[model samples]
Target: MLAFFIYGCDSNNKIWEVFQEKDLLKHPYASRCGDCHQDIYNQWKNSRHAKAYISEDYKKATHNYSKTKCLNCHIPLELSKGEKPQIRNFHKEDGVNCVSCHFSSQTNSMHGPYDVFSPPHPSTKDEDFRKAFICSSCHQETYKQWKKAKVEKTCQQCHMTPVEKKDLIQKFPFHWFHLAKEVYNHEFKTGKIKDLKVKVKKEGNTLLLTITNNQIPHNFPTADNGKPKVYVFVETFKNDKKIEEDNALITPKFAFIYNKPKILEFNFFEDFDKVKVVIYRKLSWQKKKEKITEKIFNFK
Candidate 1:
């Protein structure tokens, strides 16, 4: 429902300051996690999660919400230490630290404390701890949806597969790469042509423009809502005189078609050798307080 991430880093600075206090450091879980899941720990060290607090998006979103309450989830490690008492210092780049869910005391587990001091790191003898709960604690809604759909399989089931996961998990230099990789080409680049051509010509008082959807896998704007419109304008000035001005707007029929190429046609009469055309797919967002112009073509 929320527009995802959109806030500033007011809480981040406070989080680190609060974390430094003696009361907060009473619970030490990060060092324990580093001992067991050393490989995953090392991999996650450079991962996006490791820098969740520092992310510009997370910083902004947390600032807009109630600082005290939101900082608890935003900086779970400081909450487990019980130093600041209430949510305050959550704006630090280390927003979500390793101690968030990993701790030694069993009392800190679950929704209340949101702490787990002693989790089964890979170096620890127990390998069974690498189960779904590790991911479910944060992705509760998604986990619920998967459970209801009876597709709550192992992470490897989907993440390390043939059809969907082939490109991402292949052999590479490092055991794991934080950035996502793919075997198949992206949707936008799937069927794109090597060379694309567009030209316009003049015939007496009229102009002709041609556009080719050469290498596009689908269409120019191959999206859910395909309603596209084109506006053409022509103006002629001769001997310091505004001789004539004409404009035409056209809307395509396949507005709702899922995926397909679209060929448009337009013709207008004016004494000028140049004209302007614009195309729009949808309405602009009200929050975007600016005039947006899309001139498809201009010929002389």
Candidate 2:
């Protein structure tokens, strides 16, 4: 459950609501996102968000699970209103694409920093919609950290800050970086996630777990150089009773050697009956890593 409270009837708030809602398949944005922002359409075509599902990370993460849950964030509009794809098309869909956020039919009246207007979609357009809450729909943990720090901003405050430009289409570009100019516009750079999976096995009250970096195109957490962690955790319970726990932190430097199915073995007393394996994010608040855990039974 989320502790953050959303408010008001605005575009930002509506977007947040859409994120919180379990079913947004029938929303207009899911079908009619290409009407406006033709320029963004071309730019996003080559963006990381567009490639998220096709990326190695996504494939490995959803390899064995129902594709629907993964596609909700990766391909926002694919399964809307009972529409399911015969075969998963990663490149054509997936991730938090442009249409996912700016699907309204409203017009932009204000321009420049702190500018606010009704985005071109049927969704509600209000003050909260213009804030970072919209982006927080996916990056809930980062949003919590930002809220805890009392930062006076949203995800776009840092990720989409406009940069001054004289040789560009306008004076300011919402995204302003030149790292991947050839592949796509530097201004439209979105973060990438690597697939990290953990498998657990049991043998005579003892548990052994392995983790692998399955689908990282660039790196486990992101393509851009930064500090992050890939860690494994073990928690033991005996007949529904708490027993012991252990955690291991792995970094990119360490991952180079231990990238394979790195093994972690755990021994439990005959009294213990269950074990849990958690592959959680240890990266800083800014990395926006997703956390996953698995549990298994052990007979003693």
Candidate 3:
């Protein structure tokens, strides 16, 4: 029966194992993958993916899952390239778990970045896992934003940061079977605040501030469902006493897209000793805006 099932699949999508539909369904929990992939699984535990469905912020944002569209990415059955995964009917607590990204129902196997020889569950080589398109389904807007930037770097290049010469699995016997290769972090990464660059110019009492997203490759404070904000605070001082204070907010709608320059002009209309510019950011899930960077420009 399994042999017939294996032969029934598309030639290009065939995996090694002859697995029935139920065979793949047997292992339903994310923790099951941790038995062998201890390190990788541990990293995933600290990731936002782990908190996707259970996040209090997510629940509140979705109005307690009243929005059905939001559930697809949170507890996905299987994520496909170029399309959002279907919502799973069971184990919703797993929340974007291992099988959500790796398992393929079509072939009844785990699809990963590299081919594996395993006696446990079926795994096959899939280069699509190495590309940014795999992330496009859920990060639709950010994926579009990245495509506009026209950079060669994939989402994994920055988010699932690569470290060379590491074994993919850590379990004793599994480690003995697998060879060391380039390993990427399961805990997706975010850009550093220091990577943001600001240039200030003065023309009489007017200040021209050019903020460049030199490193962050996606929209600044980007969000799909929730509103994130970027704030630019401008303060002018005379004799060390503050004279004027102003702020500009960049919402997700009016964002500083990746590698783009956003310009702000502050017309003071009068002389001041110095000006201070501080930028703060609040991500979609954050409770408060955190300081990104600050700079002081002297007009003395």
Tell me how many clashing residue pairs each candidate has: 23, 20, 0
lDDT of 3: 0.81
Give a tens-digit lDDT track for model 3, residues 213-287: 877677887776767899999999988888888899999888887778889998885678789999999876778
Q: Local distance difference test, per candidate?
A: 0.37, 0.47, 0.81
Clashes of 2: 20
Q: Which ten residues in a row have the lowest lDDT in candidate 1?
A: 114-123
Highest-scoring model, lDDT: 3
TM-score of 2: 0.38
Give a tens-digit lDDT track for model 2, residues 1-300: 112122234546556444333222223332233333344455566665666566665576677435656555555532222132122334344455544444432332212222333223233334544466654545444454445545455555445544433222211221221111212232344443334566767776677776665543223433122356766677788777888887777665555221446677777665466776666564432346456545464555
Q: Tens-digit lDDT track for model 1 on 1-300? A: 111221223323443343233322344444333443344355456554455455554556557444555454445553323233233253345445555544333333222211121111111222222344443544343344344444335433333232342222222321132233322211111121333344556667666655454433223323221233433354444444555655544443332121223344444445554445433332211122222233333333
Q: For every model shown, what is its TM-score relative to the native structure?
A: 0.33, 0.38, 0.87
lDDT of 1: 0.37
Residue 10 of model 2, lDDT score: 54
Model 1 TM: 0.33
lDDT of 3 at 42: 90
What pairs collide in candidate 3?
none
